[model samples]
Target: MPAATRERAIEAAVELLGAQGVRALSHARVDARAGLPPGSSSNWFRTRRALLGGIVDWIAEKERADFDPAAMPVITHLDELIEGLCAMVELQSGPYAARTRARYALFVELAGDAELGEPLRRQRREFERWTERIVTAVGITDPVPATRAVMALADGLLLHRLTVDPDLEVRPTIERAIRALARS
Candidate 1:
């Protein structure tokens, strides 16, 4: 199969997973959603596991494209880090909301299936490492712990905003949290 076709199928799977959960993901469903010929997705991903892995790959690629640290400016202050993080939050809540939902859905869906959780774990570690880099660049003395704390804060805020408070303004809140963390 062509790489573009495979990518399209993966994108469709992500959309389906987000809109209808894991149960909605299937080769045929992905083919239909992607507007490809019948069995096209199956030709690329012969099993459900393969399909899920493809989705994970797609998510990782999208994230890397969205936030390339090499392309980012140097962070000189806590507020700068806050601004970058706030932009990230905004991205998740805006155009990438569906993908974010799909990711969390996969997390829940794979929670009991250790074999299928590898891709998610890899993606998460990538995120954590990137966060650590940012935290370190902000002059945090203990970046490892600070990175974990920042991740927890961001995750909690994202969950709250997505589930309980859709209108939550997170910039100020995240800025304050980062400032406190930087000082600690």
Candidate 2:
């Protein structure tokens, strides 16, 4: 029941994130959306930042958990990788898009805060691990630089999408970037 309440809070937060971004996320809003009494979120999560962190952890864990090495299809060509990423983008809409946008926003907000810096660094390292595997599977050696580039492109694309068109399909841009990376 406690877990259910926590998840409800996350769901509410994700919805608000999608509609209004992180600027509008608050315990009162989540409580109202989740149908819980005001201050219930405080019982589960102490601070607003803690709630944001929990939401980030929840989203990241779900995405990472779905990542199965054995299920990954073998890719020998760059187009295959592009196809794979497009599929991912297609599958990862709704709450995931909001979650992604919230993460990028939170990163900017917490970048200079010494308290949250280490956790953000750890999350970045985990993302690097996942990106490195993808870059390697794309048949690239020296995936570190390529991984960084892809990450930067992905971030840029997300920012663009969030700020411009929430309904934007970024797969084509990613496909073009993949071709460019292959040429380099």
Candidate 3:
């Protein structure tokens, strides 16, 4: 299959996973959602596992595009960290919101599926490592715990925005949390 076709299918899969759920993801569904002829997705992904794995890969790709480390400023101070994190939250809450929703939905779906757990965990570890780098750059004494705390705060903030308050002003909240974490 063409790479563009494969990418389209993956994008469609993510959209389906977000708009519907795991049950909504299938070869036929992806093909239809992607506007490809029937069997196109199956040609690219032979099994449901392959399809789901493709979705994970696509999510990583989209996230990398959304959050490029090279494009970010060196976060040497708490204020910079706050600014960077607030920007990230804005991205997650705005343009990439559906993808975030899809990611969490996939996480819940993969919890019981042993076959899909490793990829999800690997993706999470990559995010944690990225967070660790930021924390370490900000002169945190214990980068690991700081990274975890920041990641937890980000997750909670995103979940809150998704569930309870879509219009929540996240920058102030994230700034205060980062200040507290920096002092700790």
TM per candidate comes to 0.89, 0.80, 0.90
Look at candidate 1 and tell me the lDDT of residue 20.
89
Decreasing TM-score order of the candidates = 3, 1, 2
Measured with C-alpha atoms, the lDDT of residue 1 in candidate 2 is: 41
lDDT of 1 by residue, 1-184 (tens): 8999988888889989988888888888899999999999989888998888778778877888777778878777788889888887777867787798888888898888777777777878988998898788779879999999888887787777667786789988898888888778
Off by over 4 Å in 1: 112-115
Number of the candidate with higher TM-score, 1 or 2: 1
Task: Give the alpha carbon lDDT tens digit for every residue of 57-83 in model 3.
Answer: 788777876676786677788888888
Q: How good is model 1 by TM-score?
A: 0.89
Best model number under TM-score = 3
Q: How accurate is candidate 1 locally (lDDT)?
A: 0.84
Candidate 3 displacement at residue 100 in angstroms: 1.3
Residue-level lDDT tens digits of model 2 in 101-172: 666666776787666555656766876777688788777767888889887876676666667776788877
Alpha-carbon shift of residue 110 in model 2 (angstroms)? 1.5
Q: How many backbone clashes does candidate 1 have?
A: 0
